[model samples]
Target: MIEVAGDSSRDGDWALVRLRVEGDRILEADADGLGARLGGLSLLEAAAVPGEPLAVDALANALGPIFRARRDSGRVAVAMSGGVDSAVALLRSGPKAIGVTLRLWLDPSGPSAERACCSPEAVLAARRTCHSLGLPHVTLDLRESFRRAVVEPFVRGYGRGETPNPCMRCNGSFRFGQLLDFARRAGADRLATGHYARIVERHGRLLLARAADAGKDQSYMLARLDPRRLRQIEFPLGDQSKERTRAEARAAGLEAAGRADSQEACFLAGDDLRAFLVRRGLAGESGAVVDDEGRELGRHDGFWQFTPGQRRGLGVATGTPLYALRTEPRANRVVVGPREALARRRVRASGRLFAPVERAEVKLRYRSPAVPARVEPASRGFVLHLDQPAYGVAAGQAAVLYEDDAVVGAGIISSSSAT
Candidate 1:
């Protein structure tokens, strides 16, 4: 027999539940604290009790360890984001499915914090959906870990004058790592999500491939996922379109059927990136905008505000138009030049390749088209030699390499050269 206790406090309401269990049954159950309602019943029976918000919150928070000993091979854990896509994913996961959500950190001052996928509102929505479907739900509070793994690097990257993609970083490492760990603790063998990417086996190795809906393919964003873990991950909407997901949700009367999609940088909570950065203590000092020939063009608030390929807000007037070519944070200077000057034939990146390849198509940005490139192995990473001079390649962005529709490798752009 083992004894376990769980407690939760919210908005001045608190509850504590202690359970003594042997195998899958709770032998002795005791509940105390304000707003708790587990009296005169087995704690195992209380697990399914309804209409008691405080009791549900305390029990759901404690279910992770209580279910850890029983390894149910057929059980699956669904990652819920309180949206139509994830709602449909849970429905398709069959009856033996459990819903899980990660409570991540968001800017408290942002106006749209409630719209973020990891906000308290989203958590309640997910719990409600699971209960509506007669399924159990779990919430993992991972704000500190998320701030460390994804938010810190994003701020530091921008401080160094690099346009970092925090979504890619979170999806690739932090999010899946936590979800899979939760699945294991919940005695689930598989983890399913609403990602619109498919997994395919190539030469006995799994690789992420583009989804059937070309316009919504997210393989590039998920390219950094460890290929070995693919066997345990499932994408229920991999072959379907976003419209189909919404239709299924509507048919099932799910509340998230018409909910808008979450924003890219969820932590920003719908605030402008510049404003968010400033709020995070990344306020910049006045700097100079200069041309390639070392002539000062104008003055700007900060060099970090500009990124490669940016054309507007330079605050400079010349005979010809100028684009931001690069930012030197050390010198506090923004370098401007002609559009042709942004062309680059070589890119150096720091990451790993899941498969061996000599030639592949590289996507420098999320919305940009893939360009054919020759891959050359480097000291700690790899170099992409473009067939044609690609323009506006920037440092700190992901360079995802693909062979046809399958992702072969991905890396963070460290530098680029004309070569």
Candidate 2:
């Protein structure tokens, strides 16, 4: 049984849906408003809410004042991560800002969960920052939603031998979606965050752009955001570098200005993912570590212990260092080889395109430089032909497309091949 609950209010719609799925079919479905009969409809064909669709002109004329009033007040709901970046953003939002901290679920047994910005201690710190600035603060308890939307899918992806990037899913999809919903209910015009990324309008469409500080640019992590929601978001730190942000924090007398940055995956909370998986009942089964040609080199406790492009922790000694090329969950095998074996010149990905450009620079990993690529339509999504081979490209990682500094499209790397 699966329950899907969504708010269409952002689109001026509402829906409550309950479903029972057995195998790949929806056995039973009960939906109210726009989600009615969702069991048989393709997701894209489903209505945003259950009512006769209203004309854009009619909706605009009816709700224009309400929208204008929100804009007039300059009220923005800022997402505070209890860190220097977000605290500084709250300070810059002026007196009309409200601080919101999302209390998400974390592994209870993880040693440093309290240190994460989503933890209770971090939440208190955010509230203190708001109080100091004479702004109101609210905390939304989203543990259940966060687990279902981000954490569970991450564990499942790893179990299937894929190295999924959960941060992108959380920030671009669930986090922004939740924040927009909260902003609508709070009667605010827009939601703000401290991310080092910019939003801009190009050819009448709002799109994401790289921050002024390119080294700290987070536009790649935010590439999956729905373009329609761009109008209601604000990035105060987009044009500011980390150095200047910290300096401003000191000038404002905020203690968090000197606080260290948070871990890459906040839910990990400084603990290893392997331990968390074990506690979640994904105990590793002994497996064989083999070369790409099926020559057994040594043994591993679990195939899930390895990720594509990983260069360390392989117990096998083959004279030369071996990098993990890929994991085969079905065969219970980990494939290791020379670093050159990981290079690939072509990639296939599945996801929607934010723009219709046929050619752009594609980035396979966050830290990897964007390489010139020829993009083309594919069966389910799109294909990328890189100008040069990239090393360590992995499935389940985002392939974000860019034209100059603007993000035009994004998708998951479903598979890759060496030229």
Name the top lDDT candidate.
1
lDDT of 1 by residue, 232-291 (tens): 999989999999989999999998898888766789876888888888888768889999
The TM-scores, one per candidate, come to 0.92, 0.82
How does each model score on lDDT? 0.84, 0.77
Candidate 2: regions farther than 4 A off:
1-72
Each prediction's number of clashing residue pairs = 0, 4
Best by TM-score: 1
TM-score computed on alpha carbons, candidate 1: 0.92
Q: Write candidate 2's Cα lDDT for 1-419 as tens digits.
A: 44333222325554344444433234455544332454654221221112322221122112211121123257788898889999998888887777777878888888856568787667667766776676656667788889999999998888888888998899878999888886775557888898999998775789999999998899999998988898898889999899999999999999789888876788898788899888876768988999989999988987887877898888898778899999999999999999999989999998767887888999999998889999987877789999999989988899999988889888889999997
Regions of model 1 farther than 4 Å from truth = 1-49, 62-69
